[model samples]
Target: MPWAVLRLHRAALAVWGAFLLATIGMLVWEAGINADSVRDRIAACGHDPGLCRIRAVVDYGGTIGWASTLVYYSFFAVAAFAGGALIGRELENGTAQLAWTQSVSPTRWLAATLAVPAVLLVAGGTVFVFVFRWAWAANRDLMGDDWTFNDVFAARGPALVAYGLCALGVGALAGVVLRRSLPALGVACGVMYLINHNLEKSREDLWPTVASGGSGGQFHPESHYWPMHLVETGIVLGVAVVATGAAFWVLRRRTG
Candidate 1:
C-alpha cells in the first residue's frame, strides 16, 4: 500500500523534492557566501563610517525573508494537495469506494493515504527547519529580522512541522466530508488560514512575556522561543489529532 501510494503521488513527491532542494540551496548560498561577502565589505570600511558599503545587506535580508515566508506559508500548499489530489480526487472519482470494496478496508486505505505524505512532510519539514534556523542565525547583523518575526519564528522550529501535519489532517477531513476536490481545496486552505491567523495574533499570550522597564512594551526574550513554539505546536497537533479522529469516524459511518 505504501509503495502504491508512492507511485501514485510520484509527481507531488518530485515537486516537493525540487522545492526542498531549491530552498535549502538558496539558504546555503545566502548564509555561507552572500552573508560572508557582506561582512567582509563592511569590515573593510575599518573605522570609516562614510566608507561603509553595506548595500548588500538589504538584498541578503530580502532573500532570507523570502525563504522564511515560503516556509511559513507552505502548509497551505500541503492542505491544498491533500484535499484536491490525495483524498478528494479519489473519493470524487469513486476510486476510494472501489478500493474499500476490495481487500482494502476503508480505515486502512485512509491510513495509507495519510501515512505516506505525513512521513514525507515530517522529513522535509525537519530539514527545512534546521537549514532555515542556521541561515537565520548566521550573521544576525545582516538580517533585519528578529525572533519575534512571524515567518522567522515558525520556520526556525517544530511549529513548521506541526503546521504541515495539521494541514494534512484538516485537508483530509475536508476531503472526506466534502467528497469533492475543488470545494475541499478551498475549505481546507480557508480553515488553515483562520487557525493560523488567530494563533499568530494570540501567540504572545501563550507564554508570559517579560516587561521591559522605562515605558517599553512587554516583549518576549530570546528564551521564550521554545516555550512559545511548543505551546503553538501542541495546539496545532491537538487540532490534527481531532481532525484525524473525525475523519476516521466519518469514514466508518459512511462505509458502514
Candidate 2:
C-alpha cells in the first residue's frame, strides 16, 4: 500500500525534495558564507548611505526573505496537491473506488494516503524549522525582520508542520466531499487562505501582551513566541483532526 502510494505521488515527492534541498543549501550558504561579507561591507560603510547600498547587502536580505517566504507559503501548494492530485483526482477518476474493490479496504486506503504525506511533511518541516532557526539566529545583525515577523515566526517553529498537516486534512475533506479535482483545489486553497488570514490577524491576542509604561502601548514580547506558537498550532491541529474525521465519515457513508 505504501509503495503504491509512493509510486503514485512520486512527482510531488520529488518536487518537495528538490525544494527542501534548494532552500537548505541557500540558507546554509548565505548564513555560513555570505553573511560575514555582508556584515563587513555594511560595517565598512560606517554611516555612509551610498556605500551601504551594495549588491551583497541586498542579496543577503533578499535571499533570506525569499527562502522564508517560500517556506511559509508552502502549505498552499500542499493543500492544492492534496485536493487536486492526491485525493480528488483518484476519486474523480474512479481509481480510489477500484482500489477498494481490490485488496485495499477503503479505510486502509485513506490511512495510507494521509499517513504517507503526513510523515514526509513532518520530516521536511522539522528540517526547515531547525535550519531556518539557525540561519535566522546566526544572521540576526543582517535581518531587518524579527521573531514577530509572519514568515519568520511560522518557519521557525512546529507551526509550520501544523499548517501543512491542516492543509492536508482540509484538502482531503474537500476532495472526499466534492469528489472533483479543480473545485476541491479551489475550495481547499480558499479555505486555507481564510484560516491563515484570520489567525495572523488575531495572533497577538493569543498571549498576553506587555504594556509600555506611561504611553500604554501593548505588544507581545519575544518570550511569547512559544506560547503564541503552541496556541496557534493547537488550533490548527484541531482543525486538522476535525477535517480528517469528517473525511472518514463522508467516505464511509458514500462507500457503504
Candidate 3:
C-alpha cells in the first residue's frame, strides 16, 4: 500500500518535473537568441531596450509564468490525479477496507499514502522558485525590482506549497464522500481547474469569481497586478483551511 502511493505521486512528479526542466532548457536558448530580438522591439517602442519586459518574462524559460503555472499545475497533477486515481481507487476497490482491518490504523495508513505525493509537490514548488529567482535576477528589468518579494516569490511559491499540502486534505474528504477513485478525481479535477482557470482569466478581478475594475486612472497599473495577488492569496488560504478541516473530519468521523 505504501509502495502503491509512492509510485502514484512520484510518477506524476517525474512527468510534471520533466516539463518544468524542459521549460528551463527552452529559456536558456531564448535568453541567448530571442532576448536580443525582444531588446530591439522594446527599443522600437521607445522603452529602454535593456529593461525589456518581454525578455524578462521569457528569461529563465519564463520563470515568472513557470513559477505561477507550476503551482497550479502541480496541484492538479498531485491533488487531482494521484488522489483522484490511486488513493481513490484503493477505497473504491475495497483495498482500504482490507488494509484497515489489518494491524495498522486508517489515519496512519492515509498519512503514509499522502507522504509520497506531498513531498514531491513541495519539491516541485521549491525547484520552480529557485529556477525563477535565478532567471529573474539575471533580467531584473523584466520582473521589475519594484515588485514586492511577496508578489514575485512568496505569493506563488508559498501558496503552491500550501496548496499541494492541502490537496491531501481534499483527497481525504473525497475518500470519505465517494468510495471510488474516478468520481473523486472528476469532482476534484473539475472544481480545481474551474476555479483556477476562471479566476486567473478574469485576473483584473478576484478569483473564484471575476469582475472588472472600479473607477480609476485610464492607465491605472494600480488596479491590476498587485490587488490580483492579494485576492489570490486570500483564496488559497481559504481553500487550504477548508480542505484541511474536511480531511480531519473524514478521519475522525470514520474512526481512522
- Model 2 poorest ten-residue lDDT run: 49-58
Model 2 residue 220 lDDT score = 77
Q: Give the TM-score of candidate 3.
A: 0.66
Could you tell me the TM-score of candidate 2? 0.95
Per-candidate TM-score against the hidden true structure: 0.94, 0.95, 0.66
lDDT of 1 by residue, 1-256 (tens): 7888899899998898899889999999999988877877777767763535546676788899888888779899999999889999999999988988889999999999999999999999999999998998887888874778898889989999999999999999999999999999999999999999999999999999888999878988889999999999999999999998999999999988
> Which is better, 1 or 3, measured by TM-score?
1
Clash count, one per candidate: 0, 0, 2
Q: Mind giving the per-residue lDDT tens digits that candidate 3 earns over 116-202? A: 666666776667656555655565544544333333533334555665665655755675577677777777766666656665565
Q: Each model's C-alpha lDDT?
A: 0.90, 0.90, 0.60
Q: Would you list the clashing residue pairs of candidate 2?
A: none
Among residues 3 or more apart in sequence or in different chains, the pairs in candidate 3 whose N, CA or C atoms overlap within 3 Å are: 27-61, 107-256
Quote model 1's TM-score.
0.94
lDDT of 2 by residue, 64-109 (tens): 8789889789999999999999999999999999999998988899
